[model samples]
Target: MENYFIESNAYNPWYNLAVEKYLADYVQKEEVILYLWQNQNTVVIGQNQNALRECRVQLLEAEGGYLARRSTGGGAVYQDLGNLCFTFVASEERYDVEEQLKIVMKACQKYGICSHFSGRNDLLTDDNRKFSGSAFSMTSRGKVQHGTLMINVDVNKLQRYLTPTQEKLKAKGIASVSSRVCNLQELNTGLTVDGMRAALRAAFEEQYGRCTELSLDMLNNDKIQEYYKMYSSWDWRYGRSPECETVYSHRFTWGEVEVNLKLHNLIISECKVYSDTLEVQFPNMLEGLLLNQRYDIQNIQIPEFHKADEELAKQLKETIMWFSGVWR
Candidate 1:
């Protein structure tokens, strides 16, 4: 198969992620694509993770770091100009995780950095310090495997923004995040982001055929812009998180209402309504009504409370929608 190499000039995390999704989902050509991109200070969370639980929101916001959600399943990651992100997009028939990892390993070897795949999806040096981590997603037409290579990352910023799970920390037997990760530039003072990119490009050309370089303008079309809108929106980035319970309380002119919801697979599995002004039967009416229903207020069916309580019902609906992660 032919090889297409795309180096994204856009540093916006949303734009780079949009380009990755567009290539995986919309590109119909049967060829292997090696996409290299970088983002400014940003924290990218996995599709299945809870952003609030995985990141230090206050620190991220104060440091001017953006948060994004990728279409892959993995833990959260922090990125900056010092980090390099690579994505391998190919058809399902040609999807090979080991082969793709080998390509990255070969590139690292070119810079005199010896690393190997460790555990599930990490590339670690001989001393067991991790420098790269990867995640994967399958599209209808193909598959995408993307990873981050730590070149000259700001370790302090990485630790400040990302709050990894306790289980992950215990598994690595590391007490702190800074102790677990190392930068390529730290290992080899001569290695730069540009030099690493060159090494990876050469490795791709050696493994695949000649490379066809694609420009940022080529990807800035209307279709990609549409995808960028989706990726950049708050709803797609945070609202599409995995099913979890969330409590929301709102006080209106009428009264206060607290909504407790248990969502399973993005569907409302259980819901409880508490309000001071709502009728006695209002909570019961909402019990099975929204069961197995996705958290969309527009599509939700609201039963008629007493005509006098219309305002209360409206407030309750709005609060429930807000708890469902729908932002107006």
Candidate 2:
């Protein structure tokens, strides 16, 4: 039988350290799972992505937050006390990614909530709202699955922290700030963060077998420490991206304007905005927008321009609508 432990404490370095150890040291025959709680605000990005395009660095730093990169492939996610995190550690030979996902889906069903797998790797409700996001990674010996379940998170703050996907901003016909999302507590008032954690624990243990709770101090083996050091390094966190150029621009009545986004993989190389008009705020405004996205322009959505004259504004709005489907 496999051993599984569920934890209730909020964000700590030890939580991920345990996961790395399970993947590396735990023999293939034994399976280990962890449910981690994080109270501090943080952004966890995917392994195979550019960090600059994933998080709003200024907002995160102003709040004195931690930005972590995970061993998964997806976008960055905002996690806080209201979120419940889960990790499954198993030998690569025994890991069945699809079967593991079904275990999560079953847990949500037990709460009287119906969830369906959406897109490449997300669990959503019938109304097309996503509550849980997951990603996976593989080492030479084993595989690791980690993700988050939203309980009572702050949607306003979440939207404010992550860069908006261009397609979503354009197709919704509303400001990115106005996008809709929900929390588990909102749907089931009787359900708390701890309650959700218990449900997952029960469901996962049923199939993978069960084990007693093991404390971090007990599992501080040498191999585990090595994986933790790797996870916490700068090269593994923000130093894993390749070269790329991003574009950000604001368009108005006078034709259109464009900006060149420069980045050295994961860091901001520089920024340059060009326009034929005499607008003086182009550089500053572009810089402000740049603070939100690290080094990409393809996904950043420039806010609608402001006009002084009512008649001119109306005409510009109509013209903007025409290009909405085009540019967006």
Candidate 3:
């Protein structure tokens, strides 16, 4: 099969993801594609994950980080400039995850970093610290195997942004997220992103015959722009989240506030507010306003109440925002 080596210069997570999907959906020829790219601060969640549960929405908002959902199923991951991402797109007839992983392993081996596949879809160093995690998905014409390579990632930011479940933390036998991850730069200080890209290109050529370089313009056309709009929209990013119910209660200096929300497809299907405060209009004002609206506070429209109930409205907004994990 012919090998096409494509390098993306886009740093936006939505653009990069659109490019990946375009390759997987549009490229139907019998060829092996090796795509290399990177993104800014972004939290990419699996297709089957609950975004609010997988990430700290407040922290991500404050840090100017983006949240995206990929087509593949895997745990949420943090990406930044320090990380390198790769996508292997190939026809189903030539699709083999182990073979794709071998190409990645060969690239890492060139830098004297001995790594091996461990668990289901991870690459770990000799000390068992995970440096890479991959996920797979299939289209009608092709298959995609994509993963992130941690080079010099910020462990503190990763820990603060990603909120893995307690069961997952327990499975790793680690209490903190930082302890389970490692960076290739720590293993070899001389390694750089450019050097890694070069090594990977050489590995691709060695494994499959000579490669032809493809430009981003060839892939970033009108079709990709439509995908970018969908991927970057709030509705597609958050509205497609799985249905869930959450009850939150908090005690303030004034009184106690409790909110129960039943969400379907990330929209507030049912909402009930209970407060011990003497104010009654606050809860009544929010009664029907939140129905059929997104769970996001930014999309919520606040109704005008009596001037006497201004403080109550402010407190009510704060309570809902806090419990819903919404931040400015």
Candidate 4:
């Protein structure tokens, strides 16, 4: 197995995200790439999350922070230069979330911070305060797992910009985002952004042995620039908010989902699904799958979910199927 490591020199969220997408899409079979980067001041949201619902856009922009929509499903997260982000991209056969997490866990232990995975996608301190939030997805070329490692985040700025979903708040039994999260610096005053990066690299090397360091010159410059255009555009960042007559919501062990439907003559005219599920493709595909279908509470035309082979698709498909029998 070949392993490569890249530490992005840029702090721009758009460029960094574009690079991530490209590496995941163009991954070589049995090859693993570990990417590390940061964004100055950004509120990154999940692909299927409602931007307006998850973030205070006007407030964040007015404060000079950017809002970025990532190619993964998860809750909105606030990132600054103090935050370190990592992505593990590999061929489907070589992708292992557990193995990737061990690298991160190993790195944190070096700083005397005993961290562990919480629930499906959160990395928490021994005392249960979350310092990192991760979301994973599948690409045409392979699978990608990327997440934030909060080092010295400004809690005030985070709370100032994000609006957590009530379901999420209720599940964690927390009143606000600030209460549930902590920066690594808060736990260990000696930790710095650069220090954590080095530790992570060391841990990665420990796991994969010698890795080929990737330089910007080796990347596809034109494709990354093209992807940057989408990440930086308003059309891709904030799509029109859905206005539906009915909303069906549920909190499964995997994630929380809110399905909105606008019906016209008993036929579903418009459908929008908002979830924090880790898989990126399924939520974005939900509208097209459910559109133009009958949505009666008694007898609705469910989508052909069996056609999807991904686990998240199967779980959400069952949830949508159950939606047919219930009403909001």
lDDT by residue (tens digit), candidate 2, 171-204: 1111112224568776677878777777877787
Q: Write the per-residue lDDT of candidate 3 for residues 141-190, one digit (tens) a residue.
A: 88999999999888888888886433211111112223388999999999
Model 1 lDDT at residue 17: 92
Q: What is the C-alpha RMSD of each candidate to the true structure, in Å?
A: 7.1, 10.2, 3.9, 14.8
| Candidates ranked, most accurate by lDDT first | 3, 4, 1, 2
The true-versus-predicted C-alpha distance at residue 188 of model 3, in Å, is 1.1
TM-score of each: 0.71, 0.67, 0.89, 0.70
Candidate numbers, best TM-score first, in rank order: 3, 1, 4, 2
Q: Which stretches of model 3 miss by more than 4 angstroms?
A: 164-179, 306-328
Worst 10 residues of 3 by lDDT: 167-176
Query: What's the lDDT for residue 144 in model 3?
Result: 95
For model 4, the stretches where C-alpha displacement exceeds 4 angstroms are: 164-179, 240-328
Better of 1 and 4 by TM-score: 1
lDDT string for model 4 (150-268, tens) is 99988888877785333221111112234388889888899999999999999999988889998888655788889999999766775422223566687877778788777543356
TM-score: which candidate is best?
3
